[model samples]
Target: MVTKTSADVVIVGTGVVGVVIAEQMLDAGHSVLMIEAGPRVSRAEVVENWRNSPLGVKGDTSVAYPSRPWAPHPMGGEKPEDAYLQFSGPDAYDQTFIRYAGGSTWHWAGTSWRLTPEDMRINSLYGVGRDWAFDYETLEPYYVRTEHKLGICGPADRTQQWPQTGTRSAPYPMPALPFSPGEVKFTEVVKTLGYNNIPVAQARNSGMPYDGRPACCGNNNCVPVCPVAAKYDAETALHRLEKKGATLLVDSVVYKVETSAQNKIEAVHFYDQHKQSHRISGKLFVLACNGLENPKLLLMSTDDRNPNGIANSSDQVGRNMMDHPARSFTVTTKEPFWSGIGPVVNSGIMETSQGSFRSEHAGAYFRYNNFARNRFVTFAALKKGLVGKALDEEIRRMTACTADIVAAHEILADPNNRLTLSDKKDWLGLPKPSIHYDVGDYVRKCWEVYSQPIGKQIAEAMGATDIKISPKFNNSKHIMGGTIMGKDASNSVVDVDCRAHDHENLFIPGGGAMAAGACGNSTITMVALALKAGDAMVDQMRGA
Candidate 1:
């Protein structure tokens, strides 16, 4: 077995959240080592991997992991699959980020949404879902810090979250994306309805330098890497940590996190590409491999100490699976605006987004900060710069276009839903994660209430002859709630600070620990929570 020098802190993943935490440690003068299971990749490869999926479509995972493109094939692929769970059942999917250096942010849409205040008090407000141990006010300051640090673009809607965020110190790093024709039409309808649509809050650089990444250049290849580096990447922060002298271990697959009898981490054991094994001890070990892998790693670390699984005191390591159930609707218009291609929309409805079954008669409710309004057809008009057939004829009409309003459904985890490890193991001899989650009945009710009306509004707004909701077959890219957090250890695996309630030295940051899913998108809130963790951990390290 090979041995490595020790680090003050050893981070198991180099995804956006892990990199963010590493940078925070470096900023605080702590030695850190970030280990990524995936091989190194460049920005061009990040975009090129998508190959030719079409311009305005969602992300394609065909070329994503050439190794284990599909799961049950053993996680012997790009990122460490042994670390993440792959579900197979009524709903089968491998909900994960990229295996390369940046994790999933390599292809994010760059849309950033602040979670609402009600998100924290799920138990109190919804009466059915669990409430966060801490409220939004505790996380408010971190939200502002993340905005400035990550360079967000938005109108700064503080009142919308009902006491979540406040006016910021610095404005957006770049100007908002120019409005297209669809946006104008949508805004008019929203105004006529006596509703105010807030400007979109996104992480894409409009045109200026924010944290050194270039501005958005209309590459339109966001699901892949941005050729111009317009979107935010955790690698940028990873490099900052490296520049500050932190160590990084790419292509290292850690198998188990060993522990001492005293309940402290003994050492982390891993292997390299050559099948060579090694071990490294740490004063503190953070498993920021993201939500799926965090608990998976914990379960794999069973040894002499606490063998019901590490911190299995509650046996809740990999329970409570939740995610945003997407329900999108399409509408065409007589008046065309820049389709949902470029960013920036005049208005979005965040009201009545987060509530309870008593209010919406669903398991829970979620609101979409719909960024794509009439904008949907703006680019459809471009038609790859061709004017012909149905698309061109529509564009040539010089009159209007189509619009799609996607309302994401929020599904709270039933005690039954979760990612449990399978008897089958990966290339590393570690058991692979088994996923078992599906949209429940109450969640469908929530979608019926939230999506049906939104579709009607779009059809009426655009004068569409008819509107149909995008088939339920189209699920979502947003995933949440595998390693859920809560006040009680019996109900949760981690706390708001993201420290695993089972292990003080271990923290799982990312979409995995969400106690409750947000009405809007979750990436921005994930970053904010990461920044919050960075600050919270420093004092803990100092023994404060």
Candidate 2:
């Protein structure tokens, strides 16, 4: 039997964007219901899972939260046919994310960065890639709200900010986290080359607590579940949303977005863990699913009126996929610049991400990974065929000497890098997501001509004895551009406020709606879009 329910506003995800929007709607005196495809587990349970896991898989982000059979997310090293996301192309879009209640933020690096004015208008200024429908000034206020909502801590000084734009309306909610010894050394060395290594604006507390959550205690475990509630993941806001009178339905895989004859979304249908169907109707529909899943569900819900898909009138529902393609340099330095002193990532070089050269090649930002190296170095030391004390000493020496610097490059929005429905089906008989990707000439040119040379110079400045640069590009998992936003309705899926062009009351926000991807973490921008969409939804409700 299919159960039916109703709410003033129905949300299809429980990630950071979803929860943020839900809270906004509830505050506006509207009834909201949020649906999550994955199961909900406590922080203690995830910590235990990570602790008891085999030493070999400790670093795997998905190891802490195993996916449900129905809501399968990709694992680290699965084969093509066995993987949840079927991938193909010159470059592998092997995006890593967990489909738990909190979504991928459960294991994210917690770096929160805002796009500069130049980033949003790349097409106009640089003649490459699509420009955002609106400018950064329109989105700046939302970014400030997002920072406060997530308790983002960053350097208060404008010079230390990521963009160095000197246009921020407000300071960070909390002061920045101090850099580790390795970061300080990297900053000093990079400065000699006329590059600035600035502190990253991250979604975690510092010094004292801001929200109900406590301040970060330097666990050095930002990913794979922060044991303490210091870090701001979507799961941390779940309880607060419930207390504000919003309904959260877990283990509910939303498979369909039902629409009326006029192309307005009326309800959404989902399948529960038992494969039982349920339908929830609402005046306004918000799809807060990720870049991949949002298009998958829309395409799956096609009817006679919408022969293409719910918001596929432009035939651009699943096109223009984008993410930061990264290359790294791992070197053994002369001195012991201990890196595992605080969060996994604390500082980055942001000035390099902006230049007139963007007209030809993409821009990139560099960061020295602050992850603890002991676990990464232990196995290599044992492989040397040494006994107890010798192996221990070797591990200590390598751990202290090793350093990793990564250059994450921005990519142009190529319509060919697309996501589509796969032939493979999950346990609930729903089609899996298949993405085809090529990092494209824009990013490759930047690496060969720009970022790589800078990386080599930085490595040499660090007094590296051994330098190894990655030969191929890897996905940063900051997915964007599937449901692209634009001014013209003929070629884009969503409008400036992320409202669907085909459906009046349907809004699809988050990473999927991003027009241009800067070389920074996109989560803050995604949440800002959610806040913008929430305002639109509130206005629509009032007009109704």
Candidate 3:
């Protein structure tokens, strides 16, 4: 049987962005309803799933939250899987995003970074990429709010932070987590090369408990699932919103958005697990369905008045797809520096992410990956035909001596690298997303000119004996720029507030609204934009 519902606000995709918006709306005493395409599972279930996973799927984060047939997510195995995203370009867009109740935050490393004032004005300063519609100053307060909401722990000293400009409005909720022996060693070695390795601001707890979650014990399983809930995830906010009177519907996939003759979003139609249809009407509609899925939904909602899709008046709904494409290398060091302690990633080199070099090529942020290498090293040891104590000794040696470093480069906004509805369909008969991706000459030049040299230098600084650099670029999973924001509507899908220019009551928040994909992880910026959009939506609802 079909059903119908009404609310003051309707949000699709119960990810961190959607939950943040819902929390704000609920706090403002507005009736909120959220739709999630995937099923809801508990933290214990996810942790157990990871624990029981096969050897090949153990480290693969997406396997922790199994995808439903109706809602498919990209998965990576020994060989990269392209079952969900159809790649059509030189480079593959093998993005891993869980469609579960809490969305992709289930697998994030919890790094919360704020873009510098200069990062928002790349076009004006660096002569490449489109500038954000507004400056960082306008977004600073919201960044603070997001940090406080997520209970981020970072260094109080501004010098230990990126940018080092003292742009913070408030101190971090907790003090920074102490670095591991490997991080200390890496930092010491890099300093000899005049490189600064600063602590990354993370959403996980440090010392004291916060927001009903315990302090992080540094289990080193930040990815796949944070078992103790020490790290912030969308599920925390979702539960908070639910307690504040927000209605959440799981296994409900929003398929079409309906707009009135006045160009105001009146209702959205969704299909449940059983393929039963339902209509949800609201005064305001927000699509927090990530970069790729958000644009796909908008393009799918074609009507008589909107033949080119609901928000495709400018033909830019699914254009300008971007991400922080990474190139990584592994090096065997001289001495043992055990890396399996603390978080998966705790610190990075942010100095190279800025400079005049960005005008010609992209800038990059480098990191010493701290993921436990037991699984990786064991596989290598077995492949070497070692047995018994020899294999054990080799595993221990490889685990402690091998250092994996990754350099993630910023990519300029190129409309040619896009996400379009594919001719193929999914289990529910909806068109799958097909991506045409090219890392562009800007990023390629960055790898050749800046990233490779710096990476080799860092390896040498650590006294590496054997080094192997990846031949091709890889996706960082920080998807951005499908429904990009701009002041103008001609070439953009949304305005500064993430409001669709074609529909007054429609808002698309999250990474899809990002104008430029910076070098660092973009989750914090996405949440900030969502908070800003929440404020806008509140103003509209209050008639202010």
Candidate 4:
């Protein structure tokens, strides 16, 4: 028999957005019960597994990810595996996510960028895309709060957008991390060209410790698992909240959000690890599931009351489906390289984010970062033939010579790029989400115009020879909207406060509700919006 527990709120995910919301709600005097399909990940286990395993991959889970409990889900400092999610046909690349606590942040690159102002209002400014029901001003405060929570480090880039993103706020919990040799060289060239080469806006504390987390040791194994908890994972916040008396149910997948005939939420029914069923009811229902999973649950819970989906009377639960299309290339040059800072502090340009440039379609500035291949093993992994310090020096020279540049992501506004319920279902017979997305023409243009010039400049500065193309593309991990926000309910999912227009007690937060897709690495914005959503829910609770 399965055990049942109850709280004022039952959060369906333990990812960053859900975790943060839970923490905020608990702090606000709300009893929250978070349901996560993955079990609690022990940091020590992750370190030991990575250290003992081949290729530094975590060996805990056999399904796909080694460190992560879920596949196609990404997190910070981890590399994404193309083999994780396999899709066939012309409409494949649409479905991608890590179904675990902290979600895909386990394998994320640790870059925490806030969305530009234009991202909030693509429809109002241009005749393209859809207008956000709420504007950037509403989200700016929450963004500041999230920055404080995650220990972000970066100088304010006023020229980019939203100059007042808290230039006067408390200093970053930690000082900025150092730039690698390749990035420093690129910085010089960019300065010579009269452009602002910005340091990465990261979630890890490097120069000093903040919020009780340890400073990054530049383990270089930022992906897979960090023996040291340098990167911010949602688990940290979730565990803290749980300690504060919030409840978290592990290995439980919420099957459907069962509601009453009066259009009021009755309870959420889920399957426990033992495959037993239980229901947990609350005054309000918050679906903190990701962009894909949120819609899937709603659609599955259809009844005579809601034939389409719960809170999806507008049939806008799984539409829009926006994600950044990144174009990355590697260039190498002979600049003397030294440093263990290969993890997240690599620097690059941000000159294009602001000011108007007319193209056939909407376009904005891009971001650049230094990336290089990691080769060689720890000193302990050295074979009998190569044990000397001199041998180590030679290995570093080859692997550290190359640099990576990740540029502006083009946002394609197509209703066709969206999520849909698959006739196929999971082990529990719940409809699994399938995404259908095709890169837009604007994405192609941004790639062609920027790649060669940026690569040639960086390679020349780094003194690298034979710059080449790396086939790895952005796997569409920044799952934005199927549930978008707009002026009209006919075209969007939620309203200004993220309240489902059809249901008063239901709310959806994070990138899943984003009206517009942003530049690469948009976690900060998600965190902010989640906080905003939590506040809105709290207000509603008080009104009741």
Candidate lDDT (C-alpha), each: 0.64, 0.90, 0.89, 0.64
How would the candidate models be sorted by TM-score, starting from the highest? 2, 3, 4, 1
Q: TM-score of the candidate numbered 3?
A: 0.98
Give the lDDT of residue 313 in candidate 4: 77
Task: Give the residue spans of candidate 1 off by over 4 A.
Answer: 1-4, 51-58, 61-89, 93-96, 156-175, 338-340, 344-347, 355-400
lDDT of 4 by residue, 368-442 (tens): 443234532333234535657866765676556555555556475577776677665455655546666766765
Scored against the true structure, residue 221 in model 3 reaches a CA lDDT of 95
- Predict model 2's lDDT versus the native: 0.90
What tens digits encode model 2's per-residue C-alpha lDDT throughout 118-184? 9999999999999999988899999999999999999988778866673699999899999988899
- In terms of lDDT, which candidate is strongest? 2
List where candidate 4 sits over 4 angstroms from the true fold: 1-3, 56-96, 156-173, 337-342, 358-372, 376-394
For residues 228-327, what per-residue lDDT tens digits would candidate 1 score against the true structure?
7777767666667767877888777777888776787767877776667788787667777766677677777787767767766777777776666666
Clashes of each: 15, 0, 0, 26
